[model samples]
Target: MDNRVLYERLGGVFAIAAVVDDFIDRVLSSPALNANPLVREAHHRVAPAGFKYLVTEQLCHAAGGPQRYTGRDMKTSHAELRISEDEWQAFLDLLKQSLDKFRVPLREQGEIFAIVQSTQTDIVV
Candidate 1:
Protein backbone atom coordinates (compact mmCIF):
# COMPACT_ATOMS: atom_id res chain seq x y z
CA MET A 1 0.00 0.00 0.00
CA ASP A 2 1.13 3.56 -0.64
CA ASN A 3 1.60 4.92 2.84
CA ARG A 4 2.70 8.38 1.95
CA VAL A 5 0.96 11.27 3.69
CA LEU A 6 -1.22 13.57 1.63
CA TYR A 7 1.46 16.21 1.83
CA GLU A 8 4.02 13.90 0.30
CA ARG A 9 1.59 12.71 -2.33
CA LEU A 10 0.95 16.33 -3.21
CA GLY A 11 4.68 17.00 -3.71
CA GLY A 12 5.36 18.81 -0.44
CA VAL A 13 5.40 22.53 0.31
CA PHE A 14 6.42 23.74 -3.12
CA ALA A 15 3.65 21.96 -4.94
CA ILE A 16 1.08 22.79 -2.28
CA ALA A 17 2.06 26.42 -2.34
CA ALA A 18 1.79 26.50 -6.13
CA VAL A 19 -1.76 25.21 -5.94
CA VAL A 20 -2.62 27.65 -3.17
CA ASP A 21 -1.26 30.48 -5.26
CA ASP A 22 -3.48 29.61 -8.17
CA PHE A 23 -6.50 28.98 -5.97
CA ILE A 24 -6.15 32.21 -4.07
CA ASP A 25 -5.71 34.17 -7.24
CA ARG A 26 -8.84 32.64 -8.66
CA VAL A 27 -10.72 33.38 -5.41
CA LEU A 28 -9.50 36.93 -5.27
CA SER A 29 -10.54 37.65 -8.83
CA SER A 30 -13.88 35.89 -8.71
CA PRO A 31 -16.81 38.27 -8.82
CA ALA A 32 -19.08 35.60 -7.43
CA LEU A 33 -17.01 35.39 -4.28
CA ASN A 34 -16.53 39.12 -4.22
CA ALA A 35 -20.28 39.64 -4.41
CA ASN A 36 -20.17 39.29 -0.69
CA PRO A 37 -18.88 42.71 0.34
CA LEU A 38 -17.13 41.33 3.38
CA VAL A 39 -15.28 38.72 1.35
CA ARG A 40 -14.37 41.30 -1.21
CA GLU A 41 -13.02 43.67 1.39
CA ALA A 42 -11.09 40.99 3.16
CA HIS A 43 -9.58 39.80 -0.08
CA HIS A 44 -8.35 43.29 -0.87
CA ARG A 45 -7.30 44.11 2.68
CA VAL A 46 -4.87 41.25 2.98
CA ALA A 47 -1.73 40.99 0.92
CA PRO A 48 -2.18 38.21 -1.60
CA ALA A 49 1.19 36.65 -0.92
CA GLY A 50 0.64 36.50 2.82
CA PHE A 51 -2.83 35.02 2.37
CA LYS A 52 -1.36 32.38 0.12
CA TYR A 53 1.33 31.64 2.68
CA LEU A 54 -1.23 31.03 5.42
CA VAL A 55 -3.38 28.83 3.19
CA THR A 56 -0.34 26.81 2.19
CA GLU A 57 0.63 26.39 5.81
CA GLN A 58 -2.88 25.39 6.77
CA LEU A 59 -3.21 22.90 3.92
CA CYS A 60 0.20 21.47 4.61
CA HIS A 61 -0.65 20.96 8.25
CA ALA A 62 -4.03 19.44 7.45
CA ALA A 63 -2.37 17.14 4.92
CA GLY A 64 0.06 15.88 7.59
CA GLY A 65 3.10 17.79 6.52
CA PRO A 66 5.78 19.04 8.90
CA GLN A 67 4.41 22.57 8.67
CA ARG A 68 2.16 23.81 11.46
CA TYR A 69 -0.55 26.27 10.65
CA THR A 70 -0.23 29.43 12.69
CA GLY A 71 -3.40 30.99 11.47
CA ARG A 72 -6.58 31.67 13.45
CA ASP A 73 -9.26 29.04 13.77
CA MET A 74 -11.68 28.76 10.90
CA LYS A 75 -14.69 29.84 12.91
CA THR A 76 -13.03 32.91 14.32
CA SER A 77 -11.42 33.87 11.03
CA HIS A 78 -14.60 33.51 9.01
CA ALA A 79 -17.05 34.67 11.66
CA GLU A 80 -17.60 38.09 10.22
CA LEU A 81 -17.69 37.09 6.56
CA ARG A 82 -21.22 35.68 6.69
CA ILE A 83 -20.69 33.25 3.83
CA SER A 84 -23.74 31.46 2.44
CA GLU A 85 -24.14 27.93 1.13
CA ASP A 86 -24.05 29.03 -2.49
CA GLU A 87 -20.93 31.10 -1.97
CA TRP A 88 -19.35 28.18 -0.21
CA GLN A 89 -20.15 25.94 -3.16
CA ALA A 90 -18.68 28.53 -5.50
CA PHE A 91 -15.52 28.48 -3.43
CA LEU A 92 -15.39 24.72 -3.66
CA ASP A 93 -15.86 24.91 -7.39
CA LEU A 94 -12.88 27.22 -7.68
CA LEU A 95 -10.85 24.81 -5.60
CA LYS A 96 -11.87 21.99 -7.90
CA GLN A 97 -10.72 24.06 -10.87
CA SER A 98 -7.37 24.54 -9.23
CA LEU A 99 -6.94 20.86 -8.45
CA ASP A 100 -7.94 19.93 -11.96
CA LYS A 101 -5.62 22.50 -13.45
CA PHE A 102 -2.76 20.97 -11.53
CA ARG A 103 -3.91 17.49 -12.53
CA VAL A 104 -3.87 16.33 -8.95
CA PRO A 105 -4.75 12.65 -8.79
CA LEU A 106 -8.27 11.66 -7.77
CA ARG A 107 -7.35 10.12 -4.45
CA GLU A 108 -5.34 13.13 -3.40
CA GLN A 109 -8.13 15.42 -4.45
CA GLY A 110 -10.61 13.44 -2.38
CA GLU A 111 -8.39 13.73 0.66
CA ILE A 112 -8.00 17.43 0.11
CA PHE A 113 -11.73 17.87 -0.33
CA ALA A 114 -12.33 15.99 2.90
CA ILE A 115 -10.06 18.40 4.67
CA VAL A 116 -11.92 21.30 3.15
CA GLN A 117 -15.28 19.82 4.02
CA SER A 118 -14.36 19.65 7.65
CA THR A 119 -14.19 23.41 7.71
CA GLN A 120 -17.51 24.06 5.99
CA THR A 121 -19.54 24.40 9.14
CA ASP A 122 -17.22 27.06 10.44
CA ILE A 123 -17.02 28.88 7.13
CA VAL A 124 -20.62 28.82 6.01
CA VAL A 125 -23.03 30.92 7.92
Candidate 2:
Protein backbone atom coordinates (compact mmCIF):
# COMPACT_ATOMS: atom_id res chain seq x y z
CA MET A 1 0.00 0.00 0.00
CA ASP A 2 1.20 3.48 -0.83
CA ASN A 3 2.37 5.48 2.17
CA ARG A 4 0.07 8.27 1.10
CA VAL A 5 -2.78 5.82 1.14
CA LEU A 6 -1.74 4.55 4.50
CA TYR A 7 -1.55 8.12 5.74
CA GLU A 8 -4.95 8.70 4.14
CA ARG A 9 -6.37 5.64 5.75
CA LEU A 10 -4.98 7.10 8.93
CA GLY A 11 -6.21 10.58 7.93
CA GLY A 12 -4.67 11.89 4.68
CA VAL A 13 -2.47 14.78 3.59
CA PHE A 14 -5.19 17.26 4.46
CA ALA A 15 -5.04 16.12 8.04
CA ILE A 16 -1.31 16.62 8.15
CA ALA A 17 -1.70 20.03 6.52
CA ALA A 18 -4.21 21.11 9.11
CA VAL A 19 -1.96 20.06 11.93
CA VAL A 20 1.04 21.83 10.42
CA ASP A 21 -0.88 25.04 9.89
CA ASP A 22 -1.97 25.12 13.48
CA PHE A 23 1.49 24.23 14.65
CA ILE A 24 3.05 27.06 12.67
CA ASP A 25 0.56 29.55 14.01
CA ARG A 26 1.21 28.52 17.56
CA VAL A 27 4.94 28.65 17.07
CA LEU A 28 4.81 32.09 15.51
CA SER A 29 2.73 33.45 18.33
CA SER A 30 4.67 31.98 21.21
CA PRO A 31 7.66 33.96 22.40
CA ALA A 32 8.67 31.22 24.80
CA LEU A 33 10.91 30.09 22.03
CA ASN A 34 13.91 32.40 22.38
CA ALA A 35 15.52 31.29 19.18
CA ASN A 36 14.12 30.55 15.74
CA PRO A 37 12.04 33.66 15.52
CA LEU A 38 9.38 33.66 12.84
CA VAL A 39 10.56 33.90 9.27
CA ARG A 40 11.10 37.59 8.49
CA GLU A 41 9.72 37.43 4.98
CA ALA A 42 6.27 38.98 4.75
CA HIS A 43 5.24 36.09 2.57
CA HIS A 44 5.71 33.56 5.36
CA ARG A 45 3.24 35.47 7.49
CA VAL A 46 0.67 36.55 4.87
CA ALA A 47 0.40 33.02 3.61
CA PRO A 48 2.03 29.87 4.88
CA ALA A 49 0.18 27.78 2.34
CA GLY A 50 3.34 27.43 0.31
CA PHE A 51 5.35 26.42 3.34
CA LYS A 52 2.56 24.11 4.34
CA TYR A 53 2.65 22.54 0.90
CA LEU A 54 6.37 22.02 1.11
CA VAL A 55 5.94 20.53 4.56
CA THR A 56 3.37 18.07 3.25
CA GLU A 57 5.59 17.16 0.34
CA GLN A 58 8.46 16.39 2.69
CA LEU A 59 6.10 14.45 4.90
CA CYS A 60 4.67 12.34 2.10
CA HIS A 61 8.12 11.40 0.95
CA ALA A 62 9.25 10.75 4.49
CA ALA A 63 6.35 8.39 5.04
CA GLY A 64 7.41 6.26 2.12
CA GLY A 65 4.90 7.71 -0.28
CA PRO A 66 5.14 8.11 -4.06
CA GLN A 67 5.74 11.84 -4.03
CA ARG A 68 9.23 13.32 -4.10
CA TYR A 69 10.34 16.55 -2.39
CA THR A 70 12.55 18.50 -4.76
CA GLY A 71 12.83 21.46 -2.43
CA ARG A 72 16.03 22.65 -0.76
CA ASP A 73 17.66 20.39 1.76
CA MET A 74 16.86 20.92 5.47
CA LYS A 75 20.41 22.01 6.23
CA THR A 76 20.42 24.60 3.49
CA SER A 77 16.87 25.72 4.03
CA HIS A 78 17.19 26.12 7.79
CA ALA A 79 20.76 27.33 7.82
CA GLU A 80 19.71 30.92 8.27
CA LEU A 81 17.04 30.25 10.84
CA ARG A 82 19.60 29.73 13.65
CA ILE A 83 17.10 27.66 15.56
CA SER A 84 17.87 26.51 19.07
CA GLU A 85 16.83 23.72 21.35
CA ASP A 86 14.09 25.86 22.90
CA GLU A 87 12.56 26.63 19.53
CA TRP A 88 12.77 23.03 18.46
CA GLN A 89 11.07 22.06 21.70
CA ALA A 90 8.35 24.59 21.04
CA PHE A 91 7.74 23.03 17.64
CA LEU A 92 7.56 19.60 19.17
CA ASP A 93 5.14 20.84 21.77
CA LEU A 94 2.84 22.31 19.18
CA LEU A 95 3.06 19.20 17.09
CA LYS A 96 2.18 17.11 20.10
CA GLN A 97 -0.87 19.22 20.75
CA SER A 98 -1.91 18.89 17.12
CA LEU A 99 -1.53 15.14 17.13
CA ASP A 100 -3.52 14.89 20.31
CA LYS A 101 -6.18 17.19 18.94
CA PHE A 102 -6.41 15.08 15.79
CA ARG A 103 -6.67 11.99 17.94
CA VAL A 104 -4.07 10.22 15.84
CA PRO A 105 -3.45 6.70 17.09
CA LEU A 106 -0.24 6.29 19.05
CA ARG A 107 1.47 4.03 16.54
CA GLU A 108 0.74 6.23 13.56
CA GLN A 109 1.59 9.35 15.53
CA GLY A 110 4.99 7.92 16.31
CA GLU A 111 5.61 7.14 12.66
CA ILE A 112 4.61 10.60 11.55
CA PHE A 113 6.47 12.30 14.37
CA ALA A 114 9.51 10.27 13.51
CA ILE A 115 9.28 11.58 9.98
CA VAL A 116 8.99 15.18 11.24
CA GLN A 117 11.88 14.44 13.55
CA SER A 118 14.12 13.41 10.67
CA THR A 119 14.90 17.11 10.25
CA GLN A 120 16.40 17.41 13.73
CA THR A 121 19.87 17.34 12.29
CA ASP A 122 19.18 20.60 10.56
CA ILE A 123 16.52 22.15 12.79
CA VAL A 124 18.62 22.26 15.93
CA VAL A 125 21.01 25.09 16.67
Candidate 3:
Protein backbone atom coordinates (compact mmCIF):
# COMPACT_ATOMS: atom_id res chain seq x y z
CA MET A 1 0.00 0.00 0.00
CA ASP A 2 1.32 3.40 -0.88
CA ASN A 3 1.57 5.14 2.48
CA ARG A 4 0.91 8.48 0.84
CA VAL A 5 -2.63 9.68 1.25
CA LEU A 6 -4.76 12.28 -0.49
CA TYR A 7 -5.06 14.27 2.74
CA GLU A 8 -1.34 14.94 2.76
CA ARG A 9 -1.41 15.62 -0.94
CA LEU A 10 -4.12 18.20 -0.25
CA GLY A 11 -2.03 19.85 2.48
CA GLY A 12 -3.89 18.17 5.33
CA VAL A 13 -6.90 19.19 7.41
CA PHE A 14 -6.40 22.94 7.39
CA ALA A 15 -6.18 23.15 3.64
CA ILE A 16 -9.12 20.85 3.13
CA ALA A 17 -11.12 22.83 5.64
CA ALA A 18 -10.31 26.06 3.83
CA VAL A 19 -11.55 24.62 0.58
CA VAL A 20 -14.70 23.34 2.26
CA ASP A 21 -15.35 26.76 3.75
CA ASP A 22 -15.14 28.41 0.37
CA PHE A 23 -17.23 25.75 -1.29
CA ILE A 24 -19.95 25.95 1.34
CA ASP A 25 -20.11 29.69 1.06
CA ARG A 26 -20.54 29.43 -2.69
CA VAL A 27 -23.21 26.77 -2.41
CA LEU A 28 -25.17 28.52 0.28
CA SER A 29 -25.30 31.73 -1.68
CA SER A 30 -25.78 30.34 -5.18
CA PRO A 31 -28.95 31.73 -6.74
CA ALA A 32 -29.36 28.62 -8.86
CA LEU A 33 -29.36 26.31 -5.87
CA ASN A 34 -31.48 28.60 -3.76
CA ALA A 35 -34.07 28.83 -6.50
CA ASN A 36 -35.52 25.57 -5.33
CA PRO A 37 -37.88 26.23 -2.45
CA LEU A 38 -36.77 23.18 -0.48
CA VAL A 39 -33.14 24.01 -0.93
CA ARG A 40 -33.70 27.63 0.01
CA GLU A 41 -35.52 26.65 3.18
CA ALA A 42 -32.86 24.18 4.23
CA HIS A 43 -30.07 26.57 3.43
CA HIS A 44 -31.71 29.21 5.56
CA ARG A 45 -32.25 26.71 8.38
CA VAL A 46 -28.73 25.31 8.61
CA ALA A 47 -25.87 27.27 10.10
CA PRO A 48 -23.25 27.87 7.43
CA ALA A 49 -20.32 27.42 9.80
CA GLY A 50 -21.63 24.11 11.06
CA PHE A 51 -22.31 22.97 7.52
CA LYS A 52 -18.77 23.91 6.59
CA TYR A 53 -17.42 21.95 9.54
CA LEU A 54 -19.33 18.84 8.57
CA VAL A 55 -18.23 19.14 4.92
CA THR A 56 -14.65 19.58 5.98
CA GLU A 57 -14.85 16.52 8.19
CA GLN A 58 -16.34 14.49 5.35
CA LEU A 59 -13.72 15.66 2.89
CA CYS A 60 -10.87 15.02 5.30
CA HIS A 61 -12.16 11.53 6.02
CA ALA A 62 -12.67 10.80 2.33
CA ALA A 63 -9.12 11.93 1.65
CA GLY A 64 -7.79 9.54 4.28
CA GLY A 65 -7.16 12.20 6.89
CA PRO A 66 -7.56 11.53 10.62
CA GLN A 67 -10.94 13.28 10.95
CA ARG A 68 -14.17 11.29 11.02
CA TYR A 69 -17.39 12.58 9.44
CA THR A 70 -20.01 13.31 12.10
CA GLY A 71 -22.63 14.56 9.67
CA ARG A 72 -25.69 12.77 8.38
CA ASP A 73 -25.34 10.41 5.45
CA MET A 74 -25.71 11.98 2.00
CA LYS A 75 -29.04 10.31 1.26
CA THR A 76 -30.56 11.28 4.56
CA SER A 77 -29.37 14.84 4.35
CA HIS A 78 -30.25 15.52 0.70
CA ALA A 79 -33.22 13.32 -0.11
CA GLU A 80 -35.67 15.99 0.84
CA LEU A 81 -33.94 18.60 -1.26
CA ARG A 82 -35.05 16.88 -4.46
CA ILE A 83 -32.12 18.26 -6.35
CA SER A 84 -32.55 18.39 -10.09
CA GLU A 85 -29.88 17.44 -12.61
CA ASP A 86 -29.27 21.09 -13.41
CA GLU A 87 -28.80 21.96 -9.77
CA TRP A 88 -26.47 19.02 -9.32
CA GLN A 89 -24.37 20.19 -12.24
CA ALA A 90 -24.36 23.70 -10.86
CA PHE A 91 -23.12 22.39 -7.52
CA LEU A 92 -20.37 20.47 -9.26
CA ASP A 93 -19.38 23.59 -11.15
CA LEU A 94 -19.10 25.49 -7.90
CA LEU A 95 -16.90 22.77 -6.45
CA LYS A 96 -14.64 22.89 -9.47
CA GLN A 97 -14.46 26.65 -9.16
CA SER A 98 -13.42 26.33 -5.53
CA LEU A 99 -10.81 23.70 -6.36
CA ASP A 100 -9.44 25.92 -9.08
CA LYS A 101 -9.30 28.89 -6.76
CA PHE A 102 -7.09 26.84 -4.45
CA ARG A 103 -4.96 25.78 -7.43
CA VAL A 104 -5.53 22.12 -6.67
CA PRO A 105 -3.50 19.84 -8.87
CA LEU A 106 -5.31 17.94 -11.58
CA ARG A 107 -4.72 14.56 -10.00
CA GLU A 108 -5.97 15.66 -6.62
CA GLN A 109 -8.96 17.36 -8.21
CA GLY A 110 -9.81 14.17 -10.05
CA GLU A 111 -9.56 12.16 -6.84
CA ILE A 112 -11.71 14.63 -4.98
CA PHE A 113 -14.26 14.74 -7.78
CA ALA A 114 -14.45 10.95 -7.77
CA ILE A 115 -15.20 10.91 -4.08
CA VAL A 116 -17.88 13.54 -4.60
CA GLN A 117 -19.31 11.72 -7.60
CA SER A 118 -19.69 8.60 -5.56
CA THR A 119 -22.31 10.40 -3.50
CA GLN A 120 -24.31 11.67 -6.48
CA THR A 121 -26.77 8.83 -6.46
CA ASP A 122 -27.48 9.46 -2.82
CA ILE A 123 -27.75 13.22 -3.16
CA VAL A 124 -29.54 13.80 -6.45
CA VAL A 125 -33.15 12.84 -5.96
Best by TM-score: 1
Is 1 or 3 the stronger prediction by TM-score? 1
Residue clash pairs of candidate 1: none
TM-score of each: 0.98, 0.78, 0.96
| Residues 68-90 of candidate 3: C-alpha lDDT, one tens digit per residue | 99989999999899999999999
- Model 1 TM-score is 0.98
RMSD of 2: 3.3
Top-down lDDT ranking: 1, 3, 2
Flag clash pairs in model 3.
Answer: none
Best by lDDT: 1
Give lDDT per model, in order.
0.96, 0.70, 0.94
The 10 consecutive residues of candidate 1 with the worst lDDT sum are 1-10
- Judged by lDDT against the true structure, how good is candidate 1? 0.96
